[model samples]
Target: MSMDINEVPSVDPKEEPHAAPPRGNLRKYDPLDMESASFSTHHGQAAKATDWMTILQLAFQSIGVVYGDIGTSPLYVYSSTFTDGIKHKDDILGVLSLILYTITLLPLIKYVFIVLRANDNGDGGTFALYSLICRYAKVGMLPSQQAEDAEVSNYQLDLPNNRFRRASRVKSTLENSKFAKYLLLFITLLGTSMVIGDGVLTPCISVLSAVGGITQATSAMTEGRVVWVSVGILICLFVVQRFGTDKVGYSFAPIITIWFLFIGGIGIFNFVNYDPSVAKAFNPKYIIDYFRRNKKDAWISLGGIVLAITGTEAMFADLGHFNVRSIQISMCTVTFPSIILAYMGQASYLRTHMEDVGETFYKSIPGPLYWPMFVVAVMAAIIASQAMISGTFAIIQQSLSLGCFPLVKIVHTSPKHEGQVYIPEINYLLMLACVAVTVGFRTTQKIGNAYGIAVVFVMTLTSALLVLIMILIWKTHIALIIGYVIIFCSVELLYLSSVLYKFVDGGYLPLAFAAILMVVMYVWNYVYRKKYTYELDNKVSPHKLKEIADNLNFHRIPGIALFYSELVQGIPPIFKHYVANVPSLHSVLVFVSIKSLPISKVPQDERFLFCRVEPRELAVFRCVVRYGYKDFHERDSFQEILVDRLKEFIREEQWISPPTISSNGDVNGNAMDNGEVTNEEEEIRRKEIVGREIELVETEYNAGVVHLLGENEVVASQGSNIGKRILIDYAFNFLRRNLRQRDEVFDIPHKRLLKVGMTYEL
Candidate 1:
């Protein structure tokens, strides 16, 4: 049977109803604690501009954070494209034509117009797209998803029944085929890894290219000095990342704004003075003519020509920080026109002075403005690097939330900006890699070769994923989908092929980085799945719990204990192992499961879900806390919020039922009939019982609270093959030991925490 798109089963329900009243077990709390808890039905939607002033402000801020990388492309595109020297003035127009068409088609039309609309509740990037697909289908491998996850504000999608029927078929094919699922995951990871690679290369190339202009300004500075100077600037740039993007954007907005104006003004000057004839490059015919005349040389030159759109992917990846309209406004108004003007000016300059092709940007500058523009160019380059670095952090955060990457310490740097994050581990590693690449490559040409490969590969993967999204999520028409694939994918593939040709000449660098990152991501996800599956198979059942309680001399202690596990439905096997080793149990037990949903933020009112486990007299309950990938959890407040919610649940349950006597003179805990009891008397009795239960919960909570965490050791099964041993015993274990642990992630107080050791052979 096919499931409706909205009917895909959640891993576990928010609340399960009970048919019977609670047994008179004074030691146990009320069984209907979850029934009265509030669950907000509010659906998350993308942020929108409410007024023109806000839109204008966001657009201004976006120029720094969103357009930095693409805006700075004017610095090197002309020089990189004509690395072999311009043979004819027409070659300049041909390359300019290619640049114009690429920016217009890819960034302006494809991403801003179409792909931006595909964002997952304002969140974008390869992982966000994958997240949307996962939500619509049962393709996600993670086992901890909860039914409450779909209720997250941004997780809801409204589709007509007819569209859903078509989407369901697409979803069915992916769910039924294991290979297809893996392929989709692999493609997403490949794109994510490339974006991470972009993080490293962007800083190296941008700073290096901008700093290289020093040699043109003064003959005194050598290439070696330029490399060191670039390294120093990169170190400073990465160091300031801890201040977060909000501050960075505020500071950078003016520099990038001025830089764009300067470049555009210079382009206009050069166009009028040298060659207004270069304006013919705006025509698409020149693109065909340029390739027709140059043939092999033109095809190879595309490797460098592709650099013009290096930062286009950032527009989508960083969409979580700024709304679509603001980004679109920034791009069309300031970014697009300025870049076009800058390139036109460079082409005009190159038309007259072909020999200056080596230092096109610096040489074209008027003598009076040379030093001033150079300073702005370097700062602008740093801003461009900032965009990619921020994008890398965002994608990695998404990957970690989905369990594809190993756990790392993620610090949400801005309380106001949900997407502004700082990852210390990734930041330092990227710094080292960027500095190393800058020092080693020492020139924009070689670094540009590597940069093009990463950029096009990510773009091509995006196009491929977008095709599936159109079919499965958007339910776009077959004809429109076909046209999209043909136009965007064809252009991306052309660039991909060209960049691949330079594999031996520095293109291998990003691919090597991507390969290592991809393996790390895949292995972490693989081991995570195996470990979860083992837990699921070996989970402790209610009957098993009864047996353990009866035979193991189990005795209830005087405090509340929270047992943390990955499972959402049943008691984790680690709890059984803990009981086997230690016979005593806490007076109240809560199986706490924390999960990250794919959306950007879970509403505060809907963050916690309470469910009562069976045999409620044992005082056992389950609490599931859900967070969006962008949500920040305050370590100290968790205990307080949980306690407050539990108390509220207790008070609510008392009012739901009032004490009543049966014919045999037993307290049946049912409502009293109007004739049997006065309304005032019943109200007093209800308040008394409610007060008693509330006092009991508070006393027990004050006694003590302990956090129980599982410290699991995963290994290949005894009879497993060599491949499993290598992956599980060596690779997975090494990463698990080196990366962040569960205790650290949750930030549980060390004095109140207990570790339960268990072994999983999977």
Candidate 2:
């Protein structure tokens, strides 16, 4: 008889169903069931503030974490821009106008309003953008995607009838063309690499500029002493990163808030007293006139002017820490105004004291408040560094989940905050890079060149990705998309060209860093995909499994064995290899495949999906444990959860197929054919069976639960080309030997673990 897919079988004895049924069993479980399962238990979007108080509180907190980097830009924007010194008073107005409009257009208009809306379930950064697009299109590099992944709550986007055709066309093109997919991947990796580079340069430049104020305060402090002080501060900043953003953000928020207020107040003082005429910079005509007058000089100065929006990407990158509303509220209400006034005030001060353009921010400060503001400046700089450092950790975590980067230890610093993570290896590397850059560059000018290259390149890549997001995901109008591309890309390209001019003069640092990082990310991803493909292609069949089980010499041990595999369907080849060599199996066998989805978090109830593999009495089951990019699974708790779920599945099977008596007085695994048993009798019998099953499962689990992990070595086949050989044999092997192993990542105890050795010739 035909049965509804969602309806659990009433008396099926040989099979057990699950939300995400294994491949080749689609007929048994409706595709729609999988879709419903994915969305029913999880939130559709990232948690958002529902009240004004929460929004305000988060906005205040964001001021410390998100706005620090951008807020501190005023400290060096003037000095960095007019490296050859300001020629005329109009130069001040021109640069200030550029700064005002750049911040307004890029950070405020483009990012806050537009790109912020493109976050992947409230998580931002280049990888988040890539994840969003991957969900909408079948362009992800991994071949392991299941239908449930597409049906994830936030993965499905609704489109208007008019836009649906266009969106579908875009998706179709991306799926059909391999080049488009690789191009998208390249753009994402490039942007991520640049952000990491910026993470290093930010601490160096921000701290150096802030501490350089010591020279202005007193000549007794040499430039060398200032550099060392900056280095010390940077070291301290990186050391505290292990504390995570929740703690660091709270401490940093007040310092950034006061820094903004101080700069705004001082700006008003300078604007009114020094040159009220500098207010004319609010007009775009000064930008045009100054550019026309200075020509190539003004064009080249964009490399420095771009630094005004240095931390703009941080606002989006750190979105996982705060909601979009909080970011918008904080930026528009607090950050934007304070920064504008700070620039106007600096320009106003420069209008009169053109000779002090090199030291405009400190020179503009009132003599009495110099030291106090200097201290605040240094503190704010460190906080700015905190924003980039935190963002770097976040991006790396996302990369790790997506299989683009090698495994690293990720510590979730706050129990209350899911997104606040600390990577010990990344933190120390950034600290060293920051120290080296600070000591190597010695001045903000050289570091600023490298900093500008990384910043504008990331922004430009964001714009490119956003264009696709607009078309395929947002289903935005073509006209609007074109306008966005023209406006944002044009300005970003101008800044990019200006920065490229300084490639020999420290601009190469970020590029060099990005190149190295890109190679590592690309090589790791290449080998990762190759390895997954090998496992998938060589998976053992059910026929082979039955043969292994039917062998007379094979014995079932009195314990549970969980064989970990990357493949979610058939048994991994390593299992076959293990059984062929060992000649033994556990009483209960579970093939566990841990899959990482593109979203932020998977619901606990929906995390484990159980399916019974054929050969009924063998006690073999498959469990797929799915995790999102931001989700964490503790070692002991995970095992407990898995065991409980297994027992629960056993009880469910017993309830569906209780023992019954046939007309011939024979006990069968179905309800009584003669109606000899009452409903209450059947209920009692089912409960007893469930109790027995649960007890048996508990006993086996208690005896010992062992984790069977594959210790596979990947190598190039003899017939493969030299390039493949080098990549697979040497590069991939080196990374594998150095990085964390699968068992270590899962924190499986050595006593409870068994490694099956094999070789994959790719």
Candidate 3:
């Protein structure tokens, strides 16, 4: 007797170690399930059974991931500010006041309080903001998006109503305008590229500044020797990136904790013994007075002063690793106060020892404590660079999934931590760049200039993007959005101007990096869009496919074949190319399209959508597998899972609409005759028949799943402009050739994969 697909035996939830709890009524409310044809309770929000130990562990883990970059700022901020020279008494108070307010406003007020709320579910970064905007508006750059993409849990937003309907206007404009969407993407990519530049500069400057402290310990230490030492340290840091951060990641918080306590303790000692009166610098009047007295000198000094907030962006970017309360409590109770006291201590010590301005961090240390503090400083610097490198990997991984970057091999270093990914190519490139900058600059002064540019520009871009989120996505009042733009943009643009003034003094490095990376992104996107349009225009219809399947001489092979492409609907033209040459096809054909949506995670139950291509016994079907940028594929046997899901889908479909044998002796359900049903009705009816039952024919287990992938070479058409030809033929082609293959990217085994090569002229 035939059985229902749902009756098929499978692993029990209690036995499945990773199975989530039953959803009960919660599945009814999930937007992802609401839009899909069916739903399962697989990916449910189970009540987490956690104790105090778990919370404490998360808090501790957060310090290492979130605060490492900012915690090490004390190593270099002072030296960079006094690089040009500072006045004896007044400059110290003014700079101290600037640093105090910069930290308070940017990291504490802006990031922790405001920006963290804008996270994509739990993930945070420039791309997170871009994804949020995409959901609210139809501005995603991916051409293959479907209506189901907006059904993800985090993608839900309030529809425009009579009360705050103005947001609809903004959304309409963005969605209708391709240029606006592309421009926003460009800004986001620019910010992302600068963050990678930060990864390069953060190590060179932070390590060099920390190691330079040894100069005061002994006269034998020279600037030349310090550069080499810093380079060696950077080499070691990047060298270990492949091993992943899981082993040392936990130690990060404790190391930073000790460093903060050490700096805070030293600050108190210096404050009490050297100059208690420097406490008055906490007042805003010092900032005002310093600027009035110094004029243009103070304006230029703002570039260096901004260094106090160098790794501030990391506070927001790494929010996915820890909760907001943990970060807030850690920052407010420990990091903020410790950093403030450290700066105050430096200002107080500088009151007497003006000559030690260049090495204030080390020189201000009490003679007995210098060696221990020096060791902590180096450790903190290593942690700082490590945080930056990891953050870069996460952002680039997001970029790759979104089609904004080339395919690269991603290795998950920690099985327990989903976010811990290591990219070998990126690690190697970053290492070389860090060492080159360290050897070339030979001092923190120039690297600081470049570092300042990267930090402020990223901040400025974030500020600009926040305006759109506030107005368009959040639907805040017009007056409030305008006010936010004015306040934040003015501050960031002020810092941008100061950094730009030092353009010749190493500020050009990040700008050059951003430009080169931006060009590569634009060229790749241009070619990708062209190829996508070509596929859509050349797609084969069901009528033509039926004709091919019905031909008397058509050859059919055994086993199931899954043909993968970027197309969301219809058979890809590449299939025709493959069949025309081979003159044969698999008995069971499934066209699968894997898409990365603009959200952080897609529910496992809602990830795959199956549909029948036509009403025929040919066993042709289509499947769309959707994933979010942060989603990780299960490491078990994907073939078994796919087959099970397919069987379940067929059973469900059969229960809903049983198939009938048609005149052609093919299994068909409610087959549409010519002109019998409207095209729209037929489409709706086709969706209803997706899960109809068909017998599952067994095949040799080893050779069962064959993945057919298209290998297409893209080239510009003849008579194209020199620029277009060069970009398409040389630059884009070069990147495509070096990128990882499709089978490797999707974890398809080489033995069962078949390549069908085709060339497209655009």
Candidate 4:
């Protein structure tokens, strides 16, 4: 059996490797050993865990929805290079070759090859990177997230005390934690915020870009109502999102596959038409010629080239949700080749009609095929926008989880599917923001004018942090730093520079927004850290500790006392007071606190806390709570655990504290919400957040800390209303514990679940 009462084994969804301790070393706590160091400095353990599918699914979904923009740029690349407006000397083959390189190197090589590989505990994006650094990186001066589980303790929650009934309910509550829900909500909100910008821009730009694309296919319909058609299609696209992605999503992968084939086919047809020279683009001579021969027009060419690489940042940020390997597979297999071919095809068509400035390009694909292609283009564009939208949610959760932001409400959207999550307040606000962005931008050209920079800035931030992770945390030699820094920073900088070139052309807007977001998140997180880290109790009193040891049953197991402490040197404030009252302390006591890590992997030397602070029988047992960044926290969990260890610690002189009564005059207990605490439950919530209530609070009147040590060995069933005090503690052998719980089992109601309408992958 698992050692901790709060430890729930993984289920089918347990397919994701949890951040729990290994079976052999799970630690349970005891409160009776006042001098026992249960939670202090101990970190000697080593184990590695992997779950590639969960990693990929999460990464893909996060960025696929919002980052799809960069993913589908292939739709335009093939044609853009061939169009007469580009003024390139390359034939179809040359254009095709160039397109191949662009797709391969920029998106695949720079991001997936390097950037995407750096994950913050399977969390991605710039902020996730920030959190990882703050927590574990030993970079000369960076602070870490060694703070308490403020979100849990900050909010006031009442735990019931019908003894057996309450313990049973609390066990169930602790087993199903709350981290996952909060994370989903936070990330979803952030993604939606970005999409509000994309929703408007994508409609105007993607459709218009495709319409402009038609002008590259052939020359028949360039003079007519392209604007009207584009606008009409965009309207329909926006309306469809309300229905959700489930039905549409079933066909998403296949449809995209077919679209890839269509893209390659068009490229091949154009290649055959002119048998274009592959060597032309490679010379660097043509690029020089274009600049020297037409210096005035080169800026526009640069702008167009820059557009080709705009979505790469989203590619990296979304990699965590889509696992690096799957992204590599998907891109190499379908997304990449098609993009290259499409670009080549567009280039080939442009070569055939050298005299035409975009006129012949549109006229080339002269049939009903344009409508289907148009729909595909719109669908792909929406997919791109959605990827970023979803990423926002993931980003927020990660940020909050790593202490970048305060707590917010998180709601799980899927029953069994861990990835299907939704946030209503976040959703409605995102919709409003997305619609506003779509209407505000009004054109892809305009949106494009401002896009690319926010992500690049994020990319820059990530690269800087990655350098810190690789060199400092990983402890690589200086020899590797040059090559790593040179290659990573160079590519990121080149793209960022391109984005910078467009700053005046409207790029500053995104950078400005990114800055604002960073500030707000940083401030909230900082405030919460300080508040939660403050003295948990202003003072620990001897009187309270005295009454606690006097009031309960002692177990036969090895007696242990576990208390958390701030500094390793001094005794815990509570313990100082605890020993004064109990007089007789346990044989061994423990002090504990989490030794957080960026990777969260336990090292070989830091697992168990065994130190002789005093002597053989009297020692301080300490432990450092080491777990994954994605795990959640629970309350009263450790206390119930001592109940079992009481059975194990048969020789120690550990005494128990009586369960305290609430100020409301009732024995209160219970979890405020449902479900296990995944990142979904442990939203990167801030401590200073108002409104939400803490689970437990110590007021002036109810000034005692209650500790329960298992099935009641003694009976002090009721308090006679006044000044009389009883001195006898009886073992309640007649009080049937199992019978009371069995009767209450059917009394609890199941949680009701409602869907937020999220399945539109179609």
Backbone clashes under 3 angstroms, per model:
2, 0, 4, 128
Candidate 4 residue-wise lDDT, 1-762, digit = tens? 002211222333412223442322222222222222222223332223447765455333333343356546655443333334545444333334434555566577767776666665445666555444333321211122222211111111123335335333433442344443233323433432332343334344555666555554557755245555555555555444443332223334554555566667766776677645543555545555555655544433344454565555555454444455666666666666666656665665666666553333344443666777656655666555555444554455455444454344443333333223333444454555444554565445555666555544555555666665554345445667677678657755765665567677667666555555544454444333332333233223435444534544522123444454332222334454444444555433555443333332233222223222322223343444433333332233543343333222221111111112233322222322334333432322211111111111112112322321111122222563221112112111221221232112112111211111111000
Write the residue-wise lDDT of candidate 2 on 126-201 in tens digits: 9999988877677888766665555455556554356378888787788789999899999999999999998999
After superposing candidate 1 on the true structure, give the runs of residues whose Cα lies further than 4 Å from its correct spot: 1-51, 163-165, 548-552, 651-693
Q: lDDT for model 1, on a 0 to 1 scale?
A: 0.82
Instruction: List lDDT for all candidates, in order.
Output: 0.82, 0.82, 0.77, 0.43
Clash pairs of candidate 2? none
Compute the lDDT of residue 9 as modeled in candidate 4. Answer: 28
TM-score of 2: 0.91
Q: Taking the tens digit of each residue's C-alpha lDDT, what string does model 3 give over 4-38?
A: 11121333333231223223111111111111233
Question: Candidate 1 on 390-432: residue-level lDDT in tens?
Answer: 8999899888878899888888877766888888889999999
Measured by TM-score, how close is model 1 to the native structure? Answer: 0.91
* Model 1 / residue 494 / CA error / Å: 1.0
| Superposed Cα deviation of residue 444, candidate 1 (Å) | 1.2
